[model samples]
Target: MASSPLNEGLISFLATHAPNDAFAETDPVKASQTLFPSTTYTDAERAEISQWVITSSHVGSPSEDAAKSAERLSSLNTHLSSRTTVLGAKPSVADIALYQKLAPVVSNWSPEERTGEQGYHHIVRHVDFVQNSPLFGLKLADKVNIDVDNVIFKIKPIDAKAEKERKKKEKEAAAAASAAASGTATPTTLTGEPAPEGKKGKKEKAKGAAQAAGEAVASIATGKPTAAPEDAQTKKKEKKEKQPKPQKPAPVEKPLSPALIDLRVGHILKAERHPNADSLFVSTIACGDPAGTDNTSEYEGQVVRTVCSGLNGLVPLEEMQNRKIVAVCNLKPVTMRGIKSAAMVLAASPRVVEGEDSHKGPVELVNPPTDAKAGDRVYFEGWEGEPEAVLNPKKKIWESIQPGFTTTDSLEVGFDVEAVPQLSGEGADKKTGVGKLKTAAGLCTVTTLKGATVR
Candidate 1:
């Protein structure tokens, strides 16, 4: 059977994603379909594109607000998260149509904006896959510079059964909440406290006299009060005294070293300017915590933390792209510009000479070995030990040790024992050496700064 003539959007899509000898300049889509008939759709894949997801997506229309554009991009990101192409596993013309629309915008996205905290990760991944995959054979000169290894978030493979159940529960909860709000459905576990007025007193009644003192309930049951109150009081006091108090666990005393800082290799998935602060850039970073860890959240299946750093002006936003660096994960999470920052990214710059502005330019992130995976343990060479779970803010441990954090002439980060006297054991306990910051992969280094204090 003869197929219908290809639409204008499909013609343009073919020109970009799958251009070849099959395409006829006069009637490209029709000509391409005649030669490479695989472009044919069996009603399974829709052949539509011009009607943009957001009118602004096709071209950044001045009339469209930024919020709508963002909303559309977010929706597209989510849609592509599970599928390789717009038509699931199939390479359809729609994939190219999306690429044509999105390529320009993604090409311009700053690292902090794309993956910084899950902003447009799936979309970026989709674009990368469509552009490079052998199935597409798309040859575009102005391709987005994507480093697959420097991914912001590595989405874990989804468990079909678990996800299905989770979604089912979520839907049930939503429905229950809706019913309760409209005053239609009765109370449910999902609808926390919206029980019918008649059922309210049942909870108290079930407890009955048992909720009263056991002795009172016993006396009341028999309609007799012949127990001595003094005897009961003496027995209760005796039992209380005999029960041993829980022993307070002794505090874990770690040596005053960078090891207490809980440093680890972190990969910034995405970064963006903090909503509440101009000088702070908020980043979504993966540092290898298990799912549901405190102050940690899931992004693309990766357990990630929202980190706020003062690298907005000091470090170029473009450089913040999904890159590996050193991070202090055990520090107490703090709210920066209304965002809870779970980790601190370590960057280096020339030491501030007291009166100089510390927020000056040329800040470089501490570079972990390129082969180092996120969450790899990083510590000062000679100071290697099990790091504390979290640094105690009251101990001022981080503050005391930070002064000794310095970069050597060779660009390597190290802990100078002389800078922090507390770490320099004297006499028999004479511990003196510059411990370089490193992971099993290699030593961490900065770009140019040497003999500079690091924080």
Candidate 2:
């Protein structure tokens, strides 16, 4: 039902080599007559030719048929050369027809002469006869016109001057129509106007009169003038008079004494598990920009820097290499399990049920949120900073400095506590009190205090 590759190749070969007479039944009897014409050869020669054609048709099978086909093919080649012109001589229709039929067979010949000088010479002679001979040329020309409908040769030159004049006339007509619709004139029109000032002034006056008359008629019909009513005018004046005096500009808001650290997207270049910590990995991250160094003094030749994080607790070390991730590069360094962890990797976790295989289990996936990346400055909506202060602040406070005054007993309260005093004399009056002050935690807890609430 389907054509095999060999068949398709054969068909393509035949179509190209014998394009003029591609169809098997191109002239039926005429084709058959050309290859085995009755008048040209004797009955014995015709019978031999018929046997040769039969043999060539069955050449694919390696039997007596193939041997016969080979012999017949050779006979056909000799017969063609003997009957028709060869080398550089004139060619006949029979020569063209025979050439097309034999070209496919000749293509399969040994490389020594398959497509060598002899074949080349035969083709050149045929092409020359088709091109130059009047009868063959007429047939080819007619076929070309029927198929392509265009001349191949550039026999005549185009009239450039006439073409330019035609295009110029069309452009001028378009310009005139455009100018008339726009109420403008071509440059040449201004020179043609007699009494230019008088004509222009009259036109302007006529336009103004027409607009005024239209407004007047509208006002009369609607019983309301197009201009503001007297009441509206009075109201506007009264409102302007009642307007408040402009207040002085508020004092310039100072920039907060804090830094806003940026979280940027970066690609991982290298990754290694922490020597002692199985849950953490040390990864070298490259943020792509050479100017985005966190520590300018320490990192000189490095386009990428190493940061130890708890990624091994999540993703495997092998999977982390060459992966893109979002990281908080400006966080203050802290030693985790004897390894220095410089930044945090942001990830999202999905809930997983128990008994699920670990490979198929739900795990947190790390991704850059909202097109964010490493070395990109993340900010609190209304906060200003050097990014690092926001990322790693030393302290955070929300104390109300102004205290309330009460009419009760005098209580000497320490900064640590605000409760009523239960003692008197030296115990209550002691200003030098020693209290344990807790150290401020890192940026995470401070950020949690300032607007980053867990839901």
Candidate 3:
């Protein structure tokens, strides 16, 4: 109802992006419809966006307590820790309202106040992200300068698998304590039956058997022919022996994580159109394999993989030559047309909607940091678990995890854990987060595509 920077930013964005609409509108709830008019949202998202728009107005209000404002800021930071925008991966008018209010406040904060070990670092990151990210379409020339590398504290991301295990152990321990309190936790033997308390105990049974053995020995030594006792001993020994049981085949090992895919930084040595296949490109890539590796040969004295990617028409041939890239190195070798491909090049393309062609153009090859040498390890953050030497195709290990591969709003490649339902744990253990793909050098990224699928 009153003039404010938050309201102005929202109106200005609506005017620029949707100028045909009424720029004089003052109601934030009504103005939101014009910001992204074509972007239809679910009922839940509409409700959330409306709530956030109102919440944005309270951040710098004169009546708001400083403590309350700090608490709210902290909550926003935590919410954005695992997400690129307030609506997780989706953009909305809420982000613009929030950015207008906080960006100015963030610009005035000192280094210690913005990125100190105990500062609102995530909030600062979000502010910088909004302005630079193309999703918002804000290209201000005097944008606040942010140093992403000057992070004062690196927060360890929440580990969903470890958290799931911790909760399971707590639940089991609580059940055990409850059973003990009821006084019904029966003592049991190794075979899962109630222990015999009044019968011949283990010690007594052993003594009786020893006595029988000694008596038999005396009878034999004294030349007393005890036919019944000898026959009884024979029957007892026979009773203890039985046919060997068949061993159960070893349990099939489930693929534990995305780390099972052996991702590596690779440098292409040569690239050419496939002689037999019109849509494929054959590339010789150096991926740090040891000499004499199977399906590998020497190229310029470096062990290289013959990788065939279906990028002939998607990515230019010049871009594929002598460039650093990320690749899946552990897949089973498959012959493409007439050439054997030992690895698959990683790339990013827009997600295919229900009716759209999945193989249309605009695919971008994933670029590893320039300093990253061929064969350097690349993995999703918080998922640095060791990779399989050679992925088992029968298990479909790569297929199960590849769906989680995605590009961030900032063009960084990452893996969204919730996309893989099987690995996302059960009920309360369910999780959601994006682990950015990285090597020791830096993050893997695309040229310009945002929110695309990386495979």
Highest lDDT against the true fold, candidate: 3
- Writing each residue's lDDT as its tens digit, candidate 1 over 51-91 gives 22223234433355898777777767766666655545445
Runs of candidate 3 exceeding 4 Å displacement = 1-255
TM-score of each: 0.49, 0.26, 0.46
Instruction: List where candidate 1 sits over 4 angstroms from the true fold.
Output: 1-242, 425-431
| Most accurate candidate by TM-score | 1
Clashes of each: 6, 12, 0
lDDT tens digits, residues 65-181, model 3?
989987888888767755556766456667777877787778887887778876877678778767765435665757778887787777775566876766664554454344434
Give candidate 3's root-mean-square deviation (CA, Å).
Answer: 21.7
Instruction: Give all candidates' CA lDDT scores.
Output: 0.68, 0.38, 0.74
Lowest summed-lDDT stretch of 10 residues in model 3? 227-236
